[model samples]
Target: MISSIFFYSTAFVLFLIGLFGVLTRKNIIKILVSLSITETAVNLFLVTVGYIKNGKAPILTNTIGSIGMNNLKFVDPLPQALVLTAIVIGLGTTALSLVIAIKLYKNYGTLNITKMGGKR
Candidate 1:
């Protein structure tokens, strides 16, 4: 079985990479992409928070024969639900940001953030 530590570390690494991209990139689209990456990493981290070793699905089935908590090791579903909502919201925001980026490019004739400033 894979350790929870692995999932955590992977999420952390993805977050750091996204952070680096957001800080270092000068293009508006690239920044938005990095922001999306960061969002994905956060979602991943949230999902990992509900991880349980040898956990079964949260759904109750008769095969298990008991509804008692003591006999079940079900993974928490809250984080998964939250992540699902976040994914939808993130998609909307990403699309909106892309539209804004298009407008910025049209107005400035450039996608580079630094270059968007008025000519010196």
Candidate 2:
């Protein structure tokens, strides 16, 4: 439940920030940074989805005299899978955005996005 709340809250905040950047920011770099923040927040939420409360490692150990194998809670596999996917996606997004930012910076010769292609 806590994870759910955190995930949603972080996502929402990131969304708002991204929207703000999209709506109000003139600089492409600032917009890109905001986009990255949103992406990171989403990735964070995705990775957090894999967390298991009180979950034990997936390693197997010899059973004790009377204990059964049923009580142990193995790490949840779903979250781990999701995290991996999110990581890949995040990397792709970062690379793509960085490339775009570089292009814009090179063309404009300045980091200020509003000034980009100003004389164009």
Candidate 3:
């Protein structure tokens, strides 16, 4: 119970920190980094949500017979799969955003958002 609370609270704090950074930062790179941080926090939260305390892996072995009506505790796997997908998507997005930022920097001769608007 306590561990779950800790995991959830930590993930929430990381999300808030990332949100603050995204809102307050002026640099495109900083914003991208904050976005990645937010993605990480969300992934962490999702994994935590699927966690089952004192639970075993969702695997059945030959020795473990009589699967029916047995008190077998297995951790949920859906959230883990979802988080993996989100991570891949996040990586693609971050890479694309960085490529755009590089192009903007080359065109405007600056990485600052405010400075980029003045000349280009």
If ranked by lDDT, best first, what sequence of candidates would result?
1, 3, 2
Compare candidates 1 and 2 on lDDT and give the better one: 1
Residue 111 in model 2: lDDT: 69
TM-score of 2: 0.66
Better of 1 and 3 by TM-score: 1
TM-score of every model versus the real structure: 0.90, 0.66, 0.89
Residue-wise lDDT of candidate 1 within 1-120, one digit each (tens)? 989899899899999999999999998988998999999999999998998999998887887656676878988999999999999999999999999998887788999988877753
In order, the Cα lDDT scores of the candidates are 0.91, 0.72, 0.88
lDDT measured at residue 27 in model 3 versus the true structure, 0 to 100: 95
Q: Candidate 2 regions off by >4 Å?
A: 1-4, 59-67, 117-120
Strongest candidate by lDDT: 1
Residue-level lDDT tens digits of model 3 in 9-54: 9899999999999999989999999999999999999988999898
In model 2, how many backbone clashes occur?
A: 1
> In model 3, which range of ten residues has the least summed lDDT?
61-70
In angstroms, give how far residue 65 of model 2 lies from its true place: 12
User: In candidate 2, which residue pairs get closer than 3 Å at backbone N, Cα or C atoms, i.e. clash?
Assistant: 50-79
